[model samples]
Target: MGNTTEVTFFILAAYGDHGQIKYLYFSCLLLLYITICLANIILISLIYVDRSLHEPMYVFLCSLFMNELHGSTTFFSVLLLHILADTHEIAIAYCNVQSFFLHAYGTTEMYNLAVMAYDRYLSICHPLHYSSRMNSCKMYSLIVFTWSFAFFKFVIPMSLRLQLPLCGNIIDKLYCANYALVRLSCQNISLNNILGVFSLVLSVAVPLIPILFSYVNIVRICYKSPKEAQVKALNTCTPQVISLLYFSVSGFFEMVETQFDLTYVPQLIRNVCMVYLFACPQILNPVMYGVRLTKIRNAFKKRFFPNSTE
Candidate 1:
């Protein structure tokens, strides 16, 4: 047999065949997609227009919102179309492309969060050196590194995946993931599995370990500092900690569901858990930042309702 596999399209099993409830599903998805767009766009605009908000933390926040937009758009734009179509199938080439972007999104978000954690650690734990440590040049370099690292990490595994002879053309999820695509391969995927595991570790562990370490130091410093300093640190870092917690929990559940037999669980519940992995971060990041961070909230107020005073 030739090394090349001939697969034309993929049917997504997660796309429910709800004859009467399809409209409801479409409406809900449309509403969600719109909300994500609006939140990210507004947050991005808030940062851009306000000159005071051009600092490193806000810059990272802006990047995070943009990543959320990219990730959601990658999944939902195709998803919304699939929802309306009679047959829920995606072309193989397009599926591969989507999988790459989505994986890029996941890795990029993790690195971005790790950067944010480092920023907070400097500001809170080493206030005196924070300015010199996270300067403009350094900040830009970190941002570039975040994107570059995520892109290269997936490119290798993705290229390897595309060469596999897929035994099946159906994915059991709403969207294409590298592993999901790899699981469909017919040939021995030992190499693919090894690469996949390595990719997952590099993507998740590399960024996450640093984040945890930063927070540990931050907490230790908070304990040693004065009451006022502790409060200030909490105020600035609470939203980020919350965002990290949400990502960790949601991501863990998704990974567990993927690895184990969750067939005993109701399809609706399982489906909700699966989509929440994608949806929660997009929704939670902006809202959590907007509400918890006083600067962003104030920026929004000043730009939109300058006349109001609390």
Candidate 2:
């Protein structure tokens, strides 16, 4: 226990000493960061400006896009900095902040998707009552609750880890993972691990309740509805369905990658698997909804290219 608390910085191991390839990494990373930022920003801006788009579904999409921006900046921006710097080392304070935001972002994202699913269900299943049920006030309240819940949820766990005396400062991933940070502690981490497991279950399962219930109802409703109604429901829910499935798959991989030993896999694949969770969703969600939702596509086109006839 000799000055275990003296650790000041942690080296990110996965970035390796790629030397000249760092420029390549920097370029690709810059492109991705910019793309995620610009796409999410434009979607949010469009939603804000176009009154026609001011509906429950679009409002939820705005919240979702905002989370995408939040998550992307939390990891990718910092990753770009490390990839370009001489050392892939992060200060202890900065590492802790990043870990907090990354974990919080995960929780926020899951609940955001859940809320979106619920919005879609109400729109399709209870169209008449949806207006009363998910009004602007209720919608904003839900958004605030999701963000606030996520913001504070990891505080205890982070505080628990901060109290531990760390004997090591090497984080294997390209970013500061909260659990990985906890693992570096030289002291007993039983409490941290137990709380981590409990938090994991709550973060993943709680949001899932609404998502599962909404989708099951949406599916059942469609099953009994007329063909035209079914097609309409399918069209309305396609973006949410795709987002939910993509999120679930990526989240599963992230869980496995973080919780299990996958040393047999190629380093590149493992690394890709780690970052894909953050990057893929931010990149795809805007593009998917913009194209799939005809109203959004038309609204954007009208805003930018009003003269063109469809």
Candidate 3:
């Protein structure tokens, strides 16, 4: 980051081409991508087609699944291409686009989870006013707010990164990351550093406050309620709490990979860690919800296998 160089394109040196092994990696990623697509698509279909799922919470879930599909495609498609290609170069403009969407993908997911927690809180803590409070208008507003706010929050970082003069053109990972690009800057990056911390608060940490508050209230209410009520709360909240924790762990891996020194670790392990940051959530969320949530499972059956008795 000392010498100035105007980098037009970036080489993704992290992609290891071990000849035949590339094919194996390609196949595995292809299979994983297909699974991610199918699982999320099925979840989205069930939510949209089943009138019983027209509620605000399910609608939020549909949005979350749609975002999963978008994120998976953005990641897997380019990765599959690079795995098969002879060169691992990405044009600067395209890299910027990918960086923006990928970052936005992560931030949007946290926001979606935050809103889902609020919906769950409203459902468990104030059932009598849930309908009025989480009306169609307000629900849609929250959904829109999540997406818009995420994209808006990430734009500042992307814009700051664009103005930087890169001292290097090689990204150490399979994908272009905003912070990685910032690390390549030849100039003083104190502003980017300051903004990075500020954006982390706005994009990641701030949303968690509300989500935690919502869950705490739910827990307090369930503690004082009947045994059946506690069971109902767990039944409704289990998938989301698991999803939130899963994503948090994945995000932690990402934060460590970017912020810490991982050069000593084997490349395969690092790559696996990076892949888990996004892929695990996409695959696990839908599968967990599909299998564990009776309403979703029954609705899926009623929609696809009508011969089965409900």
Candidate 4:
């Protein structure tokens, strides 16, 4: 209503204010970042180099690891910056870039999980056709589609945000999320909110529906098989299912926080959920897929320390 002055910068809330706690937080997050990078890198490398590990499942695992690396890097790197500077003033341009990457990676991760679920669906439901159905060309196409879909889903809302005039330069969360940014706009943001909800529904909720249905069918198929085979199937899928569940639920909670009141309790819970979303999957994924696989473990031992026989 006043002058149409555009806000140029936004302030972020630090997760913690106490100097000692902040220090502890930095130290802990740094350690986690290091672990996530190293573990995912090693897992991806092992899958790449080991001929025996070349399969549809391992390919999806590699993609997931890559997504995890990028996703965590986007958020945690900014957190590190905030901690070091002890301030939350971010330029509007930088905020847009951050928002773009965050949504891109988040959406990509969602699609990748969907791809992984479909792969499992093929493997369990149509065992004989799994190989031919998920061939290199098909896999590559799916990967491309995942990235493209994510890009469009994120870019559309981001483009809409660019048109709005920001009134205040203060974002409550540590990251430059779309809803968070939209709330600061002085213009009518009903369109942005509508698009945001639509994107969430399509990119997050829709993919999860198929994943759940696929898993249910997988479980049903496994139930009729021999106990040993069923156990093996469950073991192979348990990690991905658990990872998918955690990502989905935590993601929904974070989205809900954006729409509702942000009290201290919800904020604290959201922060904890964020750690689970960012840290836990990246940390556990490699261990579940690579380290637990005998072929990869043997390859690691053979390549790193040849003479030592375990």
Candidate 5:
């Protein structure tokens, strides 16, 4: 083999079996991908088309659903292709592309949730100032920052990997990840590890702190407010809290799997966990918002069933 530059492809070692079980796996994943796309698209359309739903909260929800769709497509599309084909190899350049988008999606999503938490905090804790504080300019600024911050976080690590000669090209996972790719580098990866940790904090902890803080203030305010105010705040805040918990738990599992060896876990169980970690959030997020948020539900019903009273 020529110097590390000659390597052109990588073997993804975590593909499902080549036997009969592959079809069952393929069928399940295909259904999941379709549902995720349809659900997110419908939500985005509803928000865009309905003038009444065009507020800060719904705008944020639309962006959140779009991010979910982007992330899911990056993972599930590549995965479905490999499942259908006999070979599970990916070109180096495209692998980097996938890593970039998936990482960005994860970070952006966390930031979106944090922004939602902030919005909720203002609406409930400081209703008098909510309208002025969350103007169009501020909303655009938050959305832009979430995308830009997440984009650059992965770019540095990816550029670093590109310069270093890879020692091997075998990635033992379903999809490409910055950490996984860096692990295959031939040179010392201290810098990469440091930056990876930095990215993790930026992606997960940065958004998480705001969510926790906002909720803390919200809880305090609700406690001191009247019974009616308490009920209203609780209904409004429940969806965001649920979304936060779901993402947190799933992100935790992903971190553990990446940092530690899980060889002892049964292969089937591990596979299920891996698939669910990514798929569940994309599928459930829209459902959580759609069913729980009365404004969205009533709007959806009205738009789809204009004539029916029930």
Candidate 6:
């Protein structure tokens, strides 16, 4: 039995113990990380330099890339450190910081996705008024609100965690999450659990409702248009929708997993989900928008190799 005053650290099981497998895993993750960084940076740069790419849709894409960059940065960089060190032990203060930033970025990404959905909603459902409604002031406000809400959602939980006395520090996950922190508490975790559930509902579920409804309505509207127009519209959003669904559902599952006995499930499932959350969106977002948008592709080509034109 561990004493309340004793601080224990968690031992994260690496992806694989086999030397060859570990090497392969590290190599793969490194490549993926590099790809994510380069892709997002180029996309952001293209949006910034090209005046023609300046539209509501591309603006939202820029925001999405920014959010994804930050979100993946928060999680994956820490993950890289863990992979190199071959340990997951974090000091209590560091853990708190990690939790704060992790939740902050995660929440920000969720809100950004909601913004994207709203942009799509306006574009497809109310095309005539999209420009008028989602104007410069409104866009600025939306960006501000997304960041503010993310900060709001994270502040209390982070503060509460700071106040709580940690009896043990055996966090199972690679990074600090609500479940991992709550489990470390020597006091009643009921309040923490309540807040956790509430945040998940608000941050994940609430926005998702509108996003799903928006997409459904978008599909309906698209069906009324010509096939090419419908395909184009669907192409614009399909990646975002896929990303939203994967991240939201996987995130919810990870949250729920914390409530159950960790021993019951295979750690592999958790690891796979964690990797999926980080890897999928970062890999797909650029392709979804950059490849599909001719303007962005041409801009990228022009920017990278100023002499390339066929």
Residue-wise C-alpha lDDT for candidate 2, range 1-310, written one tens digit per residue:
4347578889998887778998997899789889999999999999999999999889889999999999899998678888888888899889999999989888998999899889989988898999899999999999999999998999899998888898888877888888888878787888998999989987999989999999999999999999999998898788887887887898888777777777788878878877788899999999999988988998999899999998
lDDT, candidate 3, 1-310, per-residue tens: 4878878899988887779889998899999999999999989988988899999988999999988988888888678899999999999988998888888898899999999999999999999999999999999999999999988988877888899888889888878889988998889999999999998888789889989999999999999999999998998898999999989988888878888778899998889887887698999989998988888988988888999885
The residue-by-residue lDDT of candidate 4 on 146-238, one tens digit each, is 888888777778888888876777776777887888777777888888888898888878888878888999999998999998987787778
lDDT of 6: 0.76
lDDT of 4 at 17: 64
After aligning candidate 1 to the native by TM-score, how far in Å is the CA of 238 from where it should be?
1.3
Query: Please, what are the lDDT tens digits per residue for candidate 5 over residues 1-310?
Result: 2245456988888885678778887998999999999999999999999999989999999989999998999998788888877888999888988989988988998999999999999999889999999999999899889888889878887888778777688887888877888777777889888988888888888888999999999999999999999998998889888888888887787788778888787766766777776788889989988998899989999999888786
Number of the candidate with higher TM-score, 2 or 5? 2
> Whose lDDT is greatest here?
3
**Of the candidates numbered 1 and 2, which has the greater lDDT value?**
2
Across 1-310, the per-residue lDDT of candidate 1 in tens digits comes to 3344578999988777778777888899899989999999999999988999999999999989999998889988787887778888999889988989988888898899999999999988888998899999999999999988888888888888888887688787888877888877777888988987798898899998889999999999999999999998999888888888887787788677766667788777877876787787898889989998888889899989999998
Best-to-worst lDDT order: 3, 2, 5, 1, 4, 6
CA error at residue 97 for candidate 1, angstroms: 0.9
TM-score of each: 0.96, 0.96, 0.97, 0.92, 0.96, 0.89
Clashing pairs in 1: none
Error of 2 at 171 (Å): 0.7
- Counting only residues 3 or more apart in sequence or on different chains, how many pairs clash (N, Cα, C under 3 Å) in candidate 3? 0
- Cα lDDT, all candidates: 0.86, 0.88, 0.89, 0.81, 0.87, 0.76
Cα deviation of 172 in candidate 4 (Å)? Answer: 1.0
Determine the C-alpha RMSD for candidate 1 after optimal superposition of all C-alphas. Answer: 1.8
The TM-score measured for candidate 4 stands at 0.92
Best by TM-score: 3
* Count of backbone clashes, every candidate in sequence: 0, 0, 0, 0, 0, 0
| lDDT (Cα, 0-100) at 22 in candidate 5 | 82
Write out the backbone clash pairs for model 6: none
